[model samples]
Target: MAGSLRYRLQPIRKTKMYRYDQYDHLIVKERVAQYRDQVRRRLADELTEEEFLPLRLQNGLYMQRHAYMLRIAVPYGMLSSPQVRMFAHIARKYDRGYGHLTTRQNIQFNWINLEQSPDILAELATVEMHAIQTSGNCIRNTTSDELAGVAADEIIDPRPYAEMIREWSTFHPEFAFLPRKFKIAISGAEQDRAATAVHDIGLHVVKNAEGEVGFRVLVGGGMGRTPIIGSVIREFLPWQHALTYLEAILRVYNQHGRRDNKYKARIKILVKALSAEEFARQVEAEWLDIKDGPATLTAEELQRIAQYFTPPPYETLPATDAGFEGQKTDNKGFANWLKRNVKAHKVSGYAAVILSVKKTGVPPGDITAAQLDFVADLADQYSFGEVRVTHEQNLVLADVKISELFTVWQAVKAQGLATPNIGLLTDIICCPGGDFCSLANAKSIPIAQAIAEKFDNLDFQHDIGDIELNISGCINACGHHHVGNIGILGVDKDGSEWYQVSIGGAQGNNTSIGKIIGPSFSAQQMPVVIERLLNVYVQQRTEEELFIDTVQRLGIAPFKEFVYASPIPTGYTHGEDACVY
Candidate 1:
């Protein structure tokens, strides 16, 4: 809430993980200097708004509904304690006293001052962080699994590959200005935690029959006005050619992708227009020309990148900690927290913990400056001084020792970060909707608040079991409503706000889009409508069946009929002609 930026910039802290080379450091410093001058020129009435628009966007500055929003990238969702503390400082100094974590693994401050934007970038540069390629019609942050290195189901770690892509895509002259913003997500885990099926390119790390690691390539997957899942163009692409192959895909897309219509500029539209088979053919043809060019990933280069992501020096100990087990047995609250928030790590003596930011009454993914500092302390004390930001809008202490689980849980709970709702309906993934973002049709935070309040009973939420309920302010699908088991999308009818409901959508290996259930509803009717849909699911579900499976088995007819059983309002209708009550 401070209006003046007074904090002195600190010396850059040295980080062992993801160390930026001299070139990386130089790029960030030069960018900060350049942006500072740009701000000066704009303020002096030398640069017009039109002249400054693209320049400002290229640095991750956006003019939101109320103020400038600065998006800071967390490459592959990885963050160190010092870096997080910097975020807290920035939140308290330059903007409001909080930051919102986005679905793309970035943190956004919604109340930034235009003049202080350069200062913010300079502060971030002190920590080897920047906002480059975070906006504009360029390659955005390349996301990967939050549990990239330590997941038990992982065949190979994806962070090194993600880093490779980040290095390749950032400031690439040829592809700097694409048809539209491009996004890529890679997953090394078997469960697909990164939501790869919804990205422009989804790379799954796997092995071939000869026991050589490679990638399974998927192209043209996206969610927005047109929500289409990606199609697999190659079942297996050798690891050595990953970058070259990506270049080929981009080259093909660049050559033929539509540039006139911004609405239809995403690679998904092109893939659909050309057909997946034809698209694959074009990519392959382009790839032949640069199959083994300088961009080809070699074993030595991979090892160089992999060194930064090597596991921390972990203590050798028994898998089960007796103290932790006894504490779980004695405390029901701790037990519930463990059941929901704690996850299995590949190492026997360690576990991964998700510190929930979706507590009742708080906007999902919004963390205060004080809370950020608390998480930093937890990271330093128990989790190797590092944390990860999840695509689902939560933070993870990925390397917590098993013996410290109870202590970590208690610390987090005291700070209101231990909501014990990881995958339940209350653990909603939502965007900063009409409240902050200029593009939203309706307010999304209030809807999430209403639903979380309605399901205030932990016992009731636990009974409902694992389910995904996502709310997006608009069809941009930044909230990923299309893939939730129950999705809520805000829409505009005339001059009022309404919501459309969908069922049967899911993410992961078997990803599918949800179908619209019926007519839109008023804001006040949302909780009850959701209650009706859950009522149908509860009544029709077989023993211990998850929500998605039940929907897939019984179909949406039962749920749709149950929701629409009541008489339609006097002037209300479905689809484009519908009237908001």
Candidate 2:
């Protein structure tokens, strides 16, 4: 994969998202104005809490522990440099000085003053971004592989299709009020970085036997009190039929999904109520009417959307760059960053660099205003003026030249983003937990910090290799606890916060739900328990076998025995409200 390097001058697209037409702009403007009036009414005591709750939620405003929180959609996780700067401005002005990235690749601004929310939405509209469809019982932000367009193993760039769906789902009248919230995730790559298997609908883009592009669609997957991996409802659906088929599935769920029990309202429960086979049969029957209707895609429409996502002008260069290789050889730190943060790109000599927001001692996925503004400038200079948010809670520079990686690493290191811990144990995916989330059963950030501190040695983390540690403050599984190789769920017993540990879980093409290791442990005991489990993995594992692979081979029995057999459980306090170690 080597050749002579040549300069290729190309123009960068000013935008990566679906270009908003007059209709799109008008719709958003109308919604914002309506919400502004609604807020005024509520403030004037003309509206009650019951009257205003749904209105605020649909606009992505949530009343959290501290104040109103705003969730902004990063459509398909794509952001331009200008949009990034807007986020920085909003963070500094409307709320705190930082924003938290979510597992769904959305951004949450905490401490937002309720009165200023309309203004925030107004600002977002100018950037072709919004808070609509990000909350409530409708289609949430349609998540996809963070490396949607450029991943080496991608079948087709999924962003175009994701944008199509985004357009269809936005303000969809029929789905505005469903039984419960619904999420959809798409994966274009051979590997499933989007964690699609745990969403309400998981869409895997595939090429069929005849080389026609299509989707292998999964349904009934969800995480919460009952975590269920999705079942493939369609082995292969032609690209044109995606919308119609989706409509059928949603229509069936909307009609028959349990509304009496909000607990069982998710489509997953419906799939369980009737078998997956039955569910598929029903969907097929329902799809017959709508299959070739107005909703069916035209090739021209697809091309129009795809035109927005064309690759930027890439240089004709050898796969291996001398400067990149030299830096890797000359500096141990630079070598580590390359191995961890940098990922292979489909285009030769271009690599995707992940800027880890999960630095040691910081809350996972949290980034300050200044840091985001810095990233915005870096994107303009180094990454074709674009950025992407990853489901793993990190930011990605999707198109950095291999030759420039060392220089980029130096700058990134200065900003403390050059953490050589990508895909490692300490690069944790975590939710806000009890610290900021009223829904959390216990705090998650401190536990993540403790584990990261205990294993801060990069050499040890690299040796451990590619372990995913995900933590959720409660069963809502906002942090995707059910899908991590090592999953930590915060549990409340009586009144005290106790942590439950699970192993063997994973999120990918081979997704699985983890099994619990027995009773819960206190916060102080969590990191120690984790260390002991890692010790078991080290002692029992064959060389280079990933932790999840080893767990699958040996089962949780051995790890469970090591943690519980220790004296900590015996010495631990058992009071209803004690925080005893």
Candidate 3:
């Protein structure tokens, strides 16, 4: 993998990708050139880490525990096969053989030479991608549902609005140096699959009594040292005024969000301090003056941008395809994979397939260069050359034809991508914790792997139903542990590592933070703890209820007793009063 980094250094190849327009290319190109100069200046001792830190961060470069990590944003979590191949190229040339896909719909290359980062950015620019605004105190990538346009339950297509936000927030003059980083997520479906309630700003596409589309805006929701649910500021804002309203919100946040303390600088804190109603009043006042200004969206402009996201040329067919059904019945493996990985699509005779990267014993979201190329090939062969990255750290072939489902499943299975665990407990969302991150209090990957191995049986997982098991190395909540149906956080007491458990936390229509069960336990006890929780759910659940439903119906009290009944005598009970941040 070391020598392979010199993969011909080919010029970036263009593909049929959405939102990679001339304007995008130009902006990325110029930013790359600027960063290259900045790197040169730093190497020449014209700047120090303090001076060069922000410059590197805005470009998505981070000084990790071992080396620099570059986060490449996949705007709206959409990508093309050609762009994926470029990722493989970067993996071979500049870093290791694999990259980590993040919960925020981006990829992180963990091993990179600071000197060659500019060259890597230049290569990315050729393919109409960059690391701009992927980090820093500005609006990060605007993520939407992985199944946005193709979802069977979508009310509106969110890609266009997400892309618009990406453009507006990229290096915006007034917001570039905000008090804290901001994340925005939009969901156009009835179910909140995008975890919008946990973002800095969450927008849900809704319809007014007039039958016109608008946005239901929520502000201040965040997870970190302080996890708080966002508050609704606007019940209904016209679609055209979405951008202007967002600008008003940001302006108020930028002006008043505390900068003296980093922990309290997020817009969520500001909104909490001012009260949602007061914040709304201030933003409304600010919005009235510039509601119809240049940033206001126009109808023609929306349609123009939307054209890029229109569904592919789907073939008209019957509601049920005989061949697809026959293939499913004939092959048990395909049947299981279809039952888990394949989801109904808006288009008849088509399905959206999730490529599970969370296979047991493997790091939840790690994929190698060779596997990347293979998945890229699969995307080209069956999904119109497009792929979507899920917030769960998996990939999706969102528009696979039902007739070709068997073929796609076989190909992916051969490459170890068909784990048949989507939405299951083992389909864990994990982070590169203490193993790679400097901020992690404990190692996350190993704990996740341990739990995954314990519950690796497909039959057992299917019986458990949907469970969102998320783990984070620290309270930073990068793994979004707070929102997982079963959340685990790694905490370091003195020098030993232990994990704390939470229950009933969930995302979607009924978003709520999980309640911590009890004292932290050793990493080895994670599987036993999770098993006890599942056992309690199995015993108490009525009919065929889901995990979250069972937990909600019978409060966390039941499971808390099951887990902490005979506490392990490790003396890690200091967590009794520990804040579940």
Candidate 4:
């Protein structure tokens, strides 16, 4: 690895292997051979860049600012220990010694040679994973809650349905060349960890009056230049009709979705233009033809898919592990971890632990190669040889025994993975920004770094309470700025970097878009503006009121008054006064 900051920012490209069955192995092996030939032909000028672009993108290859970047699918954020180890292995062997986890729960290798991509695809195919449908204007990786099966409030496991959609949409002939990319998210829990409300098509598992399992489907919800929470189209859609209904929605979008304007190509725009009711009627009309068609999920196939995600044979344990108390009494750091990272598991003695990536001053959601290996080892040691990547870009050790949590925490902490700020203000969600992305308007990473540095005091952060601060380099909203309780968007004002702020947005069960507080602030003024906003919240908030709640009750007026009061210069200095932004 190079020591230069530019080199450190460079992406890695590695060969990945998948865990495949006989049929899948054969198909992927053949596809690799085919792709290898395609690569050769393209290199030989048999195919033009324009013609080869889509072909390569469909295989997860992108010609980025620096090099060809490959995005590998981690379907529904699920990964076995073996899969995780393979990812670590690829990271170590490739261009760099690390990989980046995306907002979509996929892993991206930022540097690769075009000639080596087929070899990489071949390696991934061996592990039952691939970059297929990771790019291009088609249904991408179907995401779900990381806590799908184990959450106490879950109605059903969503992975089987996610897998079903993955299979149906992979290389679907009609949707391959749609106007724009499509994303679908499913959630089984009452909590919206999957961000279902912000997807192109969102499905929430539900049971109707008859106690029959089905889907409460919503359409046209997405975050970007136009952010809208999905509107419910069907109160109850039978479970078996998942594929058929989704196909109908996609077909309509593929035909009528905007192709003339790239900015408005998303299906969310179409849904907005027609209204949710009109979109529903259009889908209903289309579904009439495919209701009983081949795309309808079959019971036997669903059963087979469900088997892969069946709960591990967990041993019964006592409600409270006696060993845990002694461990907590001995270690303060471990105790703090238990307080912040652990979540309630459905099983009594088992715990789901969130391995926070939001360590102060580091880029949020970043894990090094060594850290990845350590997590793999911890998963194998404590969990059921499995790990899950969260929508928030953290790792989850889902089946750790309460008795072993102390040991797990110690190991995680040693590897710099035990940041005790899961949903705190410092746990910012940010995109690659101007540092790596070609589409960025300004650098988001530096802004996040500045914010984290200014708020490094844990007590101050806790006092400010839970705030979802999201930053996006551009209007695409990959960092989910629209739904952040405090959103920051990077915009190019002339040639300088300016950030627009929004407040009161949320993405849980009660989803709402953030409202702009006032005018944009220059990068140098951002940290001060944020401080003023927090000061306003702290002063106006009643007992136990969160930043969001305070804003909701009193509105953004008080915060606005302080933020716009002084009209600071572009490179303004606020003395040594931390409170006066």
Q: Which candidate ranks first by lDDT, i.e. highest? A: 1
* Model 3 misplaced regions, further than 4 Å: 1-17, 567-581
Give the TM-score comparing model 1 with the true structure, all chains together: 0.95
Quantify all predictions' global Cα lDDT against the true fold: 0.89, 0.88, 0.87, 0.82
The ten-residue window of minimal lDDT in model 2 covers 1-10
Each prediction's Cα RMSD? 5.9, 6.2, 6.2, 6.8
Candidate 2, lDDT over the whole model: 0.88
lDDT of 1 by residue, 257-299 (tens): 8999999999999999999999999999999999977788788
- 1-581 in candidate 3: lDDT tens per residue? 01111112122333334545555566678888899999999999999989999899989999989999999989999998989999999988888899999999899999999999999999988877889889989888998899998889999988878877776777678888899999999999988889899999999999999899999999999888888999999999999988888899999999999999999999989998899999999999999998998788888777666766766778897767788888878888899998899998998888999999987878999988988999899888899999889999999999888888888888888888999999998899999999999999999999898778767778888888889999999999999999999999999998989998899899988999999988898987777788778878888888889999999999999999877776543332323322111
- Give candidate 4's error at residue 63 in angstroms: 2.2
Q: What does candidate 2's lDDT look like per residue over 70-141, in tens digits?
A: 999998899999899999999999877999999889999989988899999999999878899788998888
Q: What lDDT score is found at residue 265 in candidate 4?
A: 96
Better of 2 and 4 by lDDT: 2
Task: Determine which window of 10 residues in candidate 4 has minimal summed lDDT.
Answer: 1-10
List the candidate 1 regions with Cα displacement exceeding 4 Å.
1-16, 567-581
Error (Å) of candidate 1 at residue 1 is 43
Scored against the true structure, residue 110 in model 3 reaches a CA lDDT of 98
lDDT for model 4 comes to: 0.82
